[model samples]
Target: MAVPRVLILRAPGTNCDEETAFAFEAAGAVTERVHVNRLIENPKLAEDFQVLCLPGGFSYGDDIAAGRILASQLDRHLGDMVRQFCDQDRLVLGICNGFQVLMRLGVLTSGVRETQPATLTWNDHGRFEDRWVHLAVDKTKTPCVFLKGIDKMYLPIAHAEGKFVTADAEALKAFGDAGRLALRYTAADAGQASDEVLPFPSNPNGSEANVAGICDATGRLFGLMPHPERHIDPTHHPQWTRRAQQPQWGEGFAIFKNAVDYFGE
Candidate 1:
């Protein structure tokens, strides 16, 4: 079978493209790091790949907002290509800043409107957070293919404006109802069972419902504030030396592998 192709969409300030692409390549997919401007010049270039990724970084320097400039560029020009890519059952993954761009572009919801139902905002603590975190995947709820066979993950979250807030209480519930609320922060030491508020290090950004990531209704499109690429290698973990032996691979690689497997099938 031919290896799946992944397009690692990049723009000014997008520094993680190389590592993110490396993860996908190691997972048996070929990757091309395409700049947003190139895509803007020829939107049809997106048709060449089965997966599209928006990796983490402060796009356009985050002068106005983290992903605002890049998001607008997509909304104005390549919107159709993006919509078509997801409509074809292809995949899209956004991490950290990429997640923020997806939210602003309204592509996460598969459409655009004057007002968004949810958004990524400033952390409750009003400071940047950079550390490892525990994540839980709601298998019953989310159709996010990237999380298949994964129950929990220890990944890093580095960002200042990573909080997720819904427009209203009902809206938040609807996400939960539709299984759109897929990834969440769990108590570091235990599985997700309690309804207790996960403060500080646990929740990181104090996102409502301890939300850490989410998928579209189809689950084919997903975005999260955590840096999965950073964890694709075992040594990337802070406690690698403490473990008895090196693990075969880091959990983050599973995400890209799933995407490759989906297309391979």
Candidate 2:
């Protein structure tokens, strides 16, 4: 079987595309860093990539609002292409600003309204918060191909607006009940379970219900505020002192590994 080809998007001011690509490549996939402008210029380029990723960064300088302008540009220029990808059941992910872009695209849920059931903006503790967070796995949802069988893992998060808010509380509950909530923030001690309130760094931005990551109804589309690409190695951890007994398994790579394996399977 051949390795999967993943496309990591690169937009102006976005700085993490390289590391994101490295993570996916390390996960046994052939990765490419494609510039957003070139993608727009040649829309067919998207067809070559099986998985699409919008890596974390300050795109468009986060002007007006995070991912607003870039989202608008994509909506105006590449809307059909994006819709086509989604219709084909292809995997789409937005991490941090990428999450902001997906929310703005109005694809988080089935409908489009100012207050949709899918995505929301959340304020951090006054300023940008950057650190590691622990998350639990939701096993019920099949559409969540990336997190299949993952009970929990540690991923890094860096953002000011990382909270996930939604208008459809009931729908949100349904996702949780269905096990679509892929990850949640937790404490360093690993004392908190999935049912309880997610502690700081665990639910980094204090997201509603302590959600660190989520997927669409199909589970193919995923978005998270945490930076999984940052934790692809144990060395990325700040507390290397604790590394002796428990070597960090580099959980972030699982996201990419799962994607590749899903397509290969």
Candidate 3:
């Protein structure tokens, strides 16, 4: 099978594009870091890639709101192109700030009108929080392409406005019923994943339903708060040195590997 091509989109404060590109490359995919302006100049350039990734960072200094500026640009200048890209059986992954962008662009919450049913707002603590987190994938739901073969993950998260909340109880129920709520924060020792929201440092941001990530109805487009790119290697783990034994790669590596394998299949 031919190797997949990944386009890592970056903007003025996107500091993770290089690491994201490296992760994809390590996963056996060809990757290129493209500036947002470059893609706006030639929207057709997106057609050449099998996967589009939005890595974590404070784009435009997270002014007004995280990812708002870049999201507006994409929505106004390249919305059609991106929607078409999704319809073409391609994949889109957004991490951290990128997730914020996708949410603001309404790419994740499709069919919503002028008001989004859900949004990522400031943490309940009203401050930036950065730390490693435990996450569980919702395999019972429509499987997310990026999360295929993954049950749980230990990844790092860094953000101030990362709390996932819905407009109301009904909307939250709708998302759960649709199986779009693909990932959630869970306790490190949790046996079975439940909707029960864990407390601070466990749930991390007081997100409704403990949501750490979500996928589109089709499961091709995904956005999450954790930084998978930062944990592709085994040594990236904070406790690697104290481990009795270690895996060949970190749990987060599988996320990118799954994206590349999706195309190979």
Q: Highest lDDT, which number?
A: 3
> Model 1 off-target regions past 4 Å?
110-115, 193-196
| The best candidate in terms of TM-score | 3
- In model 1, the worst 10-residue window by lDDT is 106-115
Please, what is the whole-model Cα lDDT of each candidate in the order they appear? 0.87, 0.77, 0.90
- In angstroms, the error of model 1 at 85 is 1.3
Query: Across residues 124-229, which tens digit of lDDT does each residue of candidate 1 receive?
Result: 9999999999988887777888989889999998999999988888777777777777889988787662235588888999898888888888889999999999
Off by over 4 Å in 3: 112-114
List, residue by residue over 182-257, the lDDT tens digit for candidate 3.
9889898983456878899998899998999988888899999999999989999999999999999988899999
RMSD of each candidate?
A: 1.7, 2.4, 1.2
**Per-prediction TM-score, please?**
0.96, 0.90, 0.97
Runs of candidate 2 with Cα error greater than 4 angstroms are 111-115, 189-196, 199-201, 245-249
